[model samples]
Target: MDTASTNHSPHLHVLHDVLTAATYEASSAMSVWTGGKISLTLDCVREVPLESISEEFDLGMEPLTMVVLTIDGDAGGTMILTFDEENGRGLAASLFKQEVSTDPEWTETEKSALMETGNILGCAYFNAIARLVQAEFVPSPPAFLQDYGPCVLEQALMLQAQCSYDVLICQTTFLKGEEKLNWHILFIPNPKIGDALQSAQ
Candidate 1:
């Protein structure tokens, strides 16, 4: 988490800026929601190799709770937000002003809370990208998954193969005060959106 990385591909410079701005917006929205200043740590925004994603994220076979949002229109691809159970329950508890649930099964309210959080964060992220690329980007409702991190990520990568190999890695860890939370966001933009970003740059 301390190491910072960047891709020097001139083709990716504009894209990095777009994703960075999106993270900033997401941080602001989170701060407003919590009534306390919160920020997302952007260690690097780069084009990550598909094959290296598992190693890069240290995903291994660990089960993680994640949200996936598919995007369509002028831009395309999917966005994934991942966090462990502790972080997920803690976040929901904060928003709902209730104790974190100890149950293994997610209740209807818990699912709704987490998905809504994903919607807020995804909207903030896509809004920035749309502004930079000057294109329409529509995000579908979030789908929650509890499975091996690498498995979910692999499915996402397979979907990306249909469009382009340009997978953008925007590594962020949510921060409340000085404490780092186990939240991360990963997204891949299809060629259509990639082209728009390059042209805009």
Candidate 2:
């Protein structure tokens, strides 16, 4: 295998492990908040190409927001988590219980709840990664976005060009109240980070 492929393999495994742990953490957090069970299906983490999204959802329907959360690494790349609006709202609702509507009118408590939940989920993901890699990683404050398509693509391109590697996409699902929603997390390691992992063996 070439350098790129070789580097991608182990990182993907690391991402997979982190994602699996994150799924369990997210489900546990939701269960605690809602007093309901949360289960993740295997199909959740399977990566889907960007083109396949059209077949996944109805077009011409209300465009859902895709929120991307990225953690910039000291080595030069970033780790990102993206979520569709439906799943985002569902997660927000699951954590907050009230203020589940898609309205901009958010109470102070609702805002705090959303931020707290995002922090918790993001921390769980990175903590698993830190354990697997045996390195300390600190994530910046979480950021939110109300745009998708070109906007998301542009942001991803910026991160990729800076790191010179394609992002590893991990899809996640949160099930609650007879509802199943999907979210995505992208593991974009910096070139140096990739090189370190490749050279480890």
Candidate 3:
């Protein structure tokens, strides 16, 4: 029997528990903003070789609206919130208290609405992660982009690839009412934060 392998399970379980709570907190905040109960479904949480992304990953063909933000201060890294056409417009309309149809092109007002949603949602998620680790995490002003998913994500992942080949990523999907919203949030934790998570155990 491998005693070391058995002992490692508890630490992994603890970390997963903490992370799950933080993610739920984030989803709750977003639900409030949307004036609806939005649920988040965790798609994947794992560490992957950065190099494999270019060769193996497909971010699908849907047009995406994305927000990219940097985490500064005690912990440094990046966060990205993405929405497909349906979710982006739906959310923007909710924020404006209006109805939005699925439009391939977004208006300036629509863009601003999505940007604001990103700012608020990104901060909520960052705060949760920061609290879990007891570290100060500040988010920079978000940059908005509307493009294909892979293209937009590639730009953000470029920075991570520079520093580490293996990165921790959590992908989640958001749902509004009975309809599933094409919303995704992907987080890349700083190396320092990764060390802190391990040391906390």
What local lDDT does model 2 show for residue 34?
53
| Descending-lDDT candidate ranking | 1, 3, 2
Give the better candidate number (1 or 2) by TM-score: 1
Q: List residue ranges in candidate 1 displaced over 4 A.
A: 1-4, 162-166
* Number of the top TM-score candidate: 1
Query: What global local distance difference test value does model 2 have?
Result: 0.51
Question: How close is every model to the real structure, measured as TM-score?
Answer: 0.89, 0.65, 0.79
Candidate 3 vs. true structure, TM-score: 0.79
Give the worst 10-residue stretch by lDDT in candidate 2: 1-10
C-alpha lDDT of residue 117 in model 2: 56
lDDT at 75, model 3: 52
lDDT of each: 0.76, 0.51, 0.67
Could you give candidate 3's per-residue lDDT for residues 1-201 as a string of tens digits? 001111133434444555566667767767777776676655555667876764444567866778888886435567778886767777778788887865666788888887777787778667766776787776898888877877766666666677788655666667766666667777666655656666666
Residue 49, candidate 2: C-alpha displacement in angstroms: 8.1
What TM-score does candidate 2 get on C-alpha atoms? 0.65
